[model samples]
Target chain A: MIEVNDIHKSFGDSKILKGITTVFDKGKTNLIIGQSGSGKTVFLKTLLGLYTPEQGSIVYDGRNYSDLSSDEKSDLRAEMGMVFQGSALFDSMTIAENVMFPLRMFTKQSKSEMQDRVDLVLKRVNLGDAHKKLPSEASGGMQKRVAIARAIVNKPKYLFCDEPNSGLDPRTATVIDNLIQEITQEYDITTIINTHDMNSVMEIGEKIVFLKDGLKEWEGSNKNIFKTDNEAVTGFVYSSDLFKRVQKMYLEEDL
Target chain B: MSYLHSIGQYFLMIKAMFHKPTKWSVMRHLIFKDIDDLIINSIGIVSFIAFFVGGVVTIQTALNMTNPLIPKTLVGFATRQSVILEFAPTFISIIMAGKVGSFITSSIGTMRVTEQIDALEVMGINAINYLVFPKFVALMLYPFIISIAMFLGILGGMAACVFGGFASLDDYIAGIQLDFIPFHMLYAFVKTFVFAFLLATIPSYHGFFMTGGALEVGKASTTSFVWTSVAIILLNYILTQMMLS
Candidate 1:
């Protein structure tokens, strides 16, 4: 549902992304996995039209999003949702207002109908009674859930999340990962997530794009990531303590 | 300019300015916030005007006196002239440079840095028209009101001198009307209008370029205040030469 063709981005002399290209498919969780400052955020921003690529085209569904007019781009964005890294909730607004922001801005729905949609989404995220609470009042995990509720409130056709599980505990990360996976499957929406969290890659990575220093390194699934003989993927996956143990466990079993 | 775009941008800014989910019934109440700030902050502002300017000029003119035929309350003549020409218009612009100009820059700059302005752009809103227009309207309206307040404040300080037995009422009134030109009053009012316009536009310009974050907003606000104050003081000199001279 999203295609990036030879995208190149530069900040003066510093090249952030050097000709990276990838496709994120529909009805699955597409994970862009990389270390911090690995240009994943820049890629996601390029896809969101927050940054203009120095060279390349970004096609969302069928529209040339990299070239659309501002109004047209906004219209395109209206069909999409984003879960920011910080949850980026408007501190001045309550949880309910946060979720209803997209609905009120994009949809012509009346106040009651908007409230109904807001209630439905909050309940869907298992946050029914928590709508009155502020984002500051919620825990990191609950805040992630609130962000999820806000993202899906408009029923967007495509959802982009920049590390929805970044600041959460393992259990909360898993919960958020599962919610993203479940939402992707249920709506058959194209969801692309940028993450450094290895747990997310293993849990919900139906399609994975691995990047190292701005170039696409390996493309694989969680089921076969350990089996891949590629040195880059092996080094990245095993560099983590948990993945190393998983590798050792499998190696001992085979021996 | 496309008619569609103009109307579209107008509505888009209205949307963002009201992006808060709560009901807007408290808009009138927020004006009271502005008043509270003005009343409290304007005390220091008026003191600086009254002491260094109105009071000091009176004492300076008193030092130059040699003619016993000239009223001893010649200081009151200097007081009325400087308060009307210098204090209200020029000093009030300096006050607005800190108060209102800095406020617009910081508020809009904060919105810009947080990507809130981008959110408005993504919503098809003209980030400029939406952010700048209403603030410009408010700045234009409010500083003129403060100018009147400053004018009265100077008169109040003059009353303090009279009550302290510094100058008799008859001598003060005669000295004030001695060379009192109606055109000088007209010139000062005209300059207040110019200062108000400059106060709004300069800071709004500084704010429109904000992108980084809170640090950037603070930078924009400081720049706005400094530049606007300097602009006001310099313009005051030019106008003083052209009109008051």
Candidate 2:
């Protein structure tokens, strides 16, 4: 579990993340949903220590992130995994090599031991036959699966995905979302994903935090989201005609 | 002012390269890979340029000596001086500034645009040390390539002198051995070593710090090539004045 106090971040004279506080629980899919330029990426990067907040504190489990020494921070990083929006697989390496990279960097396992673990993770991601293919040779969905495999191969305590569904088709996006949700449950890892996909918000959003212009606008699960009277949340989530009809049906069913 | 900022940032990057060194096992593979990419692959171009340019210098010197009072061996002597003093080291490095420098900048810039560097940082790796230090070590073997250029350049001069009937092979050999100052060779090598470091680091700094997409990668490569060539020429002038004058 991660607890964020009133953290504030700014770039030059313009503020990006206001004093926002939230909790991302373990063994759950925690989603940060916002429109473009709404500080979702900055907030996620701050939680990952890519950006330092000017105020407040981030406590991972019981340890404060800012209080840890450099070495301690690095050690903490080793226990965390991240899936970038582009997958960010090393173009020069094969899929197997990509998955084996973190293990090679951080583990004492022999080559065979590492290969076995890599194979297991690839299989878990339903990519057993893609061990030798380069990232460029894989499909878009396949690349995302490879990214997920690489992220979770180390059995991290925390997992973060930045716009994991971007550039993917709706069907492929659903697959990636379900995979992340399943992994969060299977490993009981604290998973935080930043996304704008409404489908993802309704599907895997066990704990959702909504942000608008750098402020926390609303917080709720998918079940409670339809019932919320908050104008910003409703306007943002049900902006499409299809979703507006869905909301109407949901409200009618609830009534 | 931007140039000054980039200069300061480049030095800071060099300083950061020594901290949190990557595991030697990983570094070893990276070094070998860079040596193959930056040095071994560059040999063909350097040698081809060196050989043909050396031949042209010999032919030009021989034709210009229309006065019967000048010795035929002077053709060999002039070729030796030109090849060793400037052609093999400085000119070849400028060519490499276009070839190898563009390569480093474009590759690293692509990585930056694609977020590969961020991935490394997220893994707790010092991205500069992981990416740049291996190139530095690989370029340490640069003088070896320059040495080959010097030898092949002189050989090309010999071939041109004999085949073109400008001078006898024996006379050319005598001219090459005539007044051979060992210090001149040392000076040439010192310049080569410095140029090698610039070739590796300047492009790296440009590529690593660049922000943008594919079009900006191309811009960074051109900018790196221009700056690297400018640095090499400026440093060559300073070193020549300090050492020779």
Candidate 3:
């Protein structure tokens, strides 16, 4: 579990995040959803310890982020995993090597031991046959899977993904979303995802935090999100025709 | 003020490279890959340039020796002096600033644009040390490349002098041995070593700190080449004034 208390962030004169406070429960898919220019990404990065808040403290489990020394921060970072929007797989390495990277860097595993772990994780992501192929050889959906495999290879306690569904087809996006949700449950990891895709929010959003202009506008589950009367939430969530119709059907059924 | 900020940032980057070192296991692979990229791959172009430019220097010196008072052996001496002092060290390095420097920048800048560096950092790896330090260590073999250039350059000069009918082989060889100051070779190697450091770090700085996407990677490579060349030239002059003057 991660606890964020009154966090503030800014760049130059433009204040991006202002006094956001929330708790991200472990073993659940926590989604930060907002429009572009909202502070969803900033808030997520701050929680990941990539950005420091000016005003409040972020405590991971029991340890406050700012109180940790640099080495301690690195130690904390090693227990965390990230999946970048671009996949960010090392282009030069084969799929197997990419997954084996974190293990090699942080662990003293032997060559065969690392290779076995890499094989297991790739199999988990359904990428067992792509061990020798480079990232460019893989399709967009395959790259996303590769990114997920690399992220979870080290068995991290916290998993953060930025726009994991972006650029993927709807079917593949759903697959990716379900995979993340499954992983979150399987490992009981604290999974935080930043996304604007409504499909993802509806599909895997166990806990959703809505942000508008850097402040938390609402927080709820996918079920409550459709019924949320908050204008900011409804305006962003039901903006699409398909979703609007879904919400209308949902309200008419009193769900 | 921006320049001052960049200078400070550059120094900070160099200092940060030594801290939080990456595991030598991963680092060894990176260093070997960089050696293949930065050093071994450069031999072809450096050799070609050194050979041709050495021949050109001999030809030019022979043409200028129209007066009988100027001995044909001086053609060899002049080729030795020009190639060793300037062509092999400074000129080849300037060329590498375009070839190797641009490669470093574009490669690292592409990683930046693609968020690969961020991935490394998020994994608790030192991105600078992981990315730049291997290039630094690989380029320590840069003086070896320069030594090859020096040999080929002088050899080309000898071949051109004998074949072009400007001088005999014995006289040219004798002229190469004439007034051969070993300190000049040391001076050239020192300059090459400094240029190698500049080559590695400046391009890395531009790449690592570059903002924007694909278009900006190309722009950063160009900027890296320009700054690296300017630094090499300026340092060359300073070193020459200090050592030779």
Top DockQ prediction, candidate number: 3
Ranked candidates (TM-score, high to low) = 3, 2, 1
As for TM-score, the candidate ahead, 1 or 2, is 2
Tens-digit lDDT string for candidate 3 (B1-245): 99999999999999988888999988999999999999999999999999989999999999988999987779889999999999999999999999999999999999999999989989889999999999999999999999999999999998988889899999899888889999999999999999999999999999999999999999999999999999999999999999899
Worst 10-residue lDDT window for candidate 2 chain B reads B115-124
TM-score per model for chain B alone?
A: 0.73, 0.98, 0.99
lDDT of 3 by residue, A1-255 (tens): 999899999998989999899999999999999999999888888887878888999999999999999999999999998999999999999999999999999999999999999999999989989999999999999999999999999999999999998999999999999999999999999999999999999899999999999999999999999988899998998788999999889999994
Residue B81, candidate 2: C-alpha displacement in angstroms: 1.6
Model 1 residue B152 distance off true place after TM-score fit, in angstroms: 2.7
The CAPRI quality class of candidate 1 comes to acceptable
Predicted structure with the largest lDDT when compared to the true one: 3
Q: Give the TM-score of candidate 1.
A: 0.81
> DockQ numbers for every candidate?
0.23, 0.77, 0.85
What is each predicted model's overall lDDT from 0 to 1? Answer: 0.75, 0.93, 0.94
Cα TM-score of candidate 3? 0.99
Docking class of 2: medium
Residue pairs clashing in model 3 are: none
